[model samples]
Target: MAQSNPRKSGYSFAPSPSSLGAGLSVPVGRRSVLGGAVGLSAMAALTACGGGGGGSDVKEGTGAISFGSNQSDAVPKAAYKKMIDTFKKDSGSKVSINTVDHNTYQEQINSYLQGEPDDVFSWFAGYRMRFFADQGLAGDVSSVWDNIGDDFSEAFKASATATDGKQYFVPVSYYPWAVFYRKSVFADKGYDIPTTLDEYISLSKEMQKDGLTPIGLGDKDGWPAMGTFDILNMRINGYDFHTSLLAGEESWESDEVKDVFDTWAKQMPYHQKGGLGRDWQEMAQGLLQKKTGMAVFGMSISQQFQGAEGGEALEDLDFFKFPKINDEHGTDSIDAPTDGFMMSAKTENGGTAKDLLEFLGSAEAEQINTEADKSIVGPATNVDTSNYTALQKKAVELVGEAKHTAQFLDRDTRPDFASTVMIPSLQAFIKDPKDINNILKDIEAQKKAIFTA
Candidate 1:
């Protein structure tokens, strides 16, 4: 999408839900955040798992059901299948999975739900879930929640609850966004962890001098860059301001907001070149290959490390909170987005869908899911943790120690605004850093229109 001048476009603002919540539904705690076992698989030949496979033929009254999944990556894809296979064996039911690319699934969710969506599907928590629930795109899962409520923490439950005080999502796992690096690389280079902005920049320069890309980022999918923006904004402006700004209660043109872009622009020279053309998996490969010093990413990056060429490198993976920029905020916040599943309102069999949703929320299901994906942890409170890897254990500690937690930029705000405005705007900024002034103006104009509408 081209950058549009809202004034010249003369587009009328369409009224939207006025009360998009300002923060997470419930505060995230250490025990409440999740991580799973890190597993490896090659990215090649990993296309849509079940492309062109339709679920329209499944009978509503039969025990068989269809599912739409975005777990197309090798580890998670296999993990989801394991869970479904278990579901089939235990219940004597059939499940047909229609898998799509993760990004495509998210971008086309509106049409998917309105069209021939499967009985249940993968989704996320936060306002993204609420937005769909309010629009009647998601089926109410409060009844499912009632049976499994005791198995989860209040924070996890709240994350799944929509604005109407009803649950529409069943959280499966969560992980924090942080600056990740290979411990071996840092040790070999005699590098120290930087806790302040100046040190962080200086360290990046040293890495560049050492023939390593200081920061490996891939924004081809658009949402990856939002993580960088979210962290920078929270670091420089404080968590409250970041939330307010994204919630549309604050202006995009504010000095605080501009400072974030300015800082990012200064840091962009250290980012991998051609980032706009690369996907996150490639960027993760850079870190595993020792071509990059660090990457600001979620725990899901582990999937890439477990690849055929880099599987053993997963053990050396470690991360630190994004360095503090403003002393007032002092690295007090982090984005720990929760991943989960939701029932489609258009399901042919609500009974089976709800039953599967209940199973998904159970400790037994969480254990199976977390065991398959090495990077995430289950959200269920009673899920076994005796087997958590060191990486997963650290992730829980990192999130627990934070003073504030966000659901990530795309999940924290209006989905329409994120998909339509922020994704393109952030990508535009990445494509051309020199155009900051115009970018801020365009964002402000769009925010006004979208928030009011």
Candidate 2:
């Protein structure tokens, strides 16, 4: 990590040890948006009962800050575990990590916050964090940022700030969304990364001729499709319209949205079939296995290559920004979601929570995270890139060079609309790309109700 750790943010807490070191997945919906207590309830029970390891020695101000986590997949889980271990060792505070399935956390976040929740929890920036802060659910972290303020860029600081102009989140890491492919696959096929819409389409058709699935698409569990829509909309209509659309300021039934749907519909034939039955993990697997030429996704897809395969296959992984579809946009925008920690408004251990946020914002914590899982780049301005895999280096550059960074679609908009309306709607489009007209109309109707509500 490159970010410099500055002042201590004037928070104090003692350490307590946690037992649940590894993260686990319960597998919620087909595609999940992300956060929660419902998913963590079972895990919490286990943590309370010491099911993950032995027993926890809970303390107050110096006590264990219950950490609500949603890093369900193994790679991030392991990375988080190491990072948490470092925190415990450094701060001498115990963290009882209640790990939950990724999708379940997001689906039940409101209830989780309203219910008794962990003192500190995983969360994203944008409307997601702002919404909770607006509802008085998230604790203010303005003071925490006062000490670590220089560690992050202004853009990241803005993302972590709530609508009320207070910092509610401490960003740690983020990954850019792009067209990921195994370099070996491209090298073997003598394929060059596409730079434009025509080049991309031509490459897809060429891959088909070579008996390779051109694009890997998995809509199961649902939100993976949102990545597709986000990139396409930005590429076609530009970022402002896309962001406005997500905010429900623009009609979903407009020609701009229709054009994105139309483009995706035409490209559907080139996408892997049976998308509704596969998750993003499975789609990443296709790229790893060389069955598919490329997958439009975040670098986190490399999580699938960890453990058994090591970084060799991942070393073969590379990406190109989704090619420019409109000269107006010119690959200027990216859905590079900012992920970080937030404190619950109800946390009785505010001191300990802020202390933990202090450690989390440090370059040391980011170093642990990035080294363990190279898929993510530490957002800390001074992060060390010496140990970075080639892909990580490229990712840092890719994100830094972006003109506009978006918190993925779900994060940028209403959670209800994203999960309830858009998820199903996009899944339907994947099932029948022909009826996009009706699908968008239905979405606009739902958008009206949800945004108004």
Candidate 3:
């Protein structure tokens, strides 16, 4: 069910009760402040299985390392734990991890700049890491990066590098976003995955005619909608325009972005009913149950879908990349989110952090990632992905050969812009499409505030 509007922002800012469970509701008056708390709880639960011994001496060469992890799903958590355990056995040094809530993990890390600090922790690439580097909380890893092979992929490195040309983090995993659909519905309707915008719209219309919601959407968490919007915008305007907007080089009101909003307005009706208040997991349930014909979501949705309904329900479920928008950005692009690790500048165990970072890049770590199914795209460039599902393998191929792949919006832009500009603008577009100019203006103002303040 939809959560009640917090009555503070005059918007339904709380996550849907069904999404995270009944007890986790968005805070009323202090939405921003309390959002972190939800994240904190989630992170703590994820990292609970991993523990480390107390800090020890450098042992002539080795050093003690402290680590923190953002709330991750069971798979990634298990993979990380295995990696840490192996590190302890190999290096003979202490490695401690302090787990926090996923929602508030970033905030908690930011607040921990005082006395004690984790040596390394998971982080998103792009502006999120840039914020920490700017604040001097992140350590410079240029020297460490110099040792990794060029085969690790330049795109991955660039994602973790700041505009000032400093490497601050190393990405361990990434996965693409696409439309997951019920194959039986498509087979019955004689509809194949649409390759053009017109075909996509026409297909959606036909699905609606057959009494099926063509798209499953959940805006209760906000980020899911933003993810769809980002993909649509990227397809419409291409990577250059998307990058310009993210780098603050282009205004939000540009014709390119306007087209994205216009497309969303035209496609809104095909979305699942009550999507505005549904959470991502709930929306995924709709797809799994076949109540909705399709859902545009992350690769992670596969795990939840299979878990909920078993593999039989997924026998007729499949995924396809968002259809091409005139092939302007190249028809083969994929959207992915990269999660990585960054070392603290104040960490007492720089050597240990470096060891872990290097270890993460090894084939052994990649094997752990694959065994745990933590990511569809593992960090080791040399690993064979023949074991991955057909769709997963396809996504990996697309990402590998693509001319460009941008990180998702929330990670690509500064947090201030993500909160004050991108998310709000997308939400405004949903509430009132005619307010495009106002939304753009508001986002621009927020961008200015970020730079000035």
Which ten residues in a row are the worst by lDDT in model 2?
A: 1-10
Per residue, candidate 3 scores C-alpha lDDT tens digits across 238-280 of 7777877886778776787778888888888888767667877
**Which regions of candidate 1 are displaced past 4 Å?**
1-78, 88-108, 111-119, 143-147, 150-155, 208-211, 277-279, 307-310, 344-355, 386-388, 402-405, 414-416, 431-434, 450-452
What Cα-based lDDT does every candidate model obtain? 0.76, 0.77, 0.66
Per-residue error for 390 in candidate 1, Å, reads 3.3
| Per-residue lDDT of model 1, residues 1-453, tens digit only | 000101001122111112232332322232322334212111111321222222223224545678888776666678788888888788777788988866556655654654567878887787778766776667888888889998876667777888779888998878788999999999999999999989999999999899999999887777788889999999999888987898789989989988999999999999999999987778888988899999999887876666445456878889998999899999888888887888877566777887888888888888887776567777777778778887888887787677777888867887668777888899899989989989999999988887885
RMSD to the hidden true structure, all candidates: 12.1, 10.2, 8.6
- Which portions of model 3 miss their true places by more than 4 Å? 1-61, 71-75, 113-115, 373-376, 384-387
lDDT of 3: 0.66
TM-score of 1: 0.73
lDDT of 2 by residue, 385-436 (tens): 8999888899888887787788887778765677678888999999999999
Candidate 2 whole-model C-alpha lDDT, 0 to 1: 0.77
Ranking by lDDT: 2, 1, 3
Better of 2 and 3 by TM-score: 3
Number of the predicted model whose lDDT against the real structure is largest: 2
Q: TM-score of the candidate numbered 2? A: 0.78
Distance from true position, residue 263, model 1, in Å? 2.5
CA lDDT of 305 in candidate 3? Answer: 50
> All candidates' TM-scores?
0.73, 0.78, 0.80
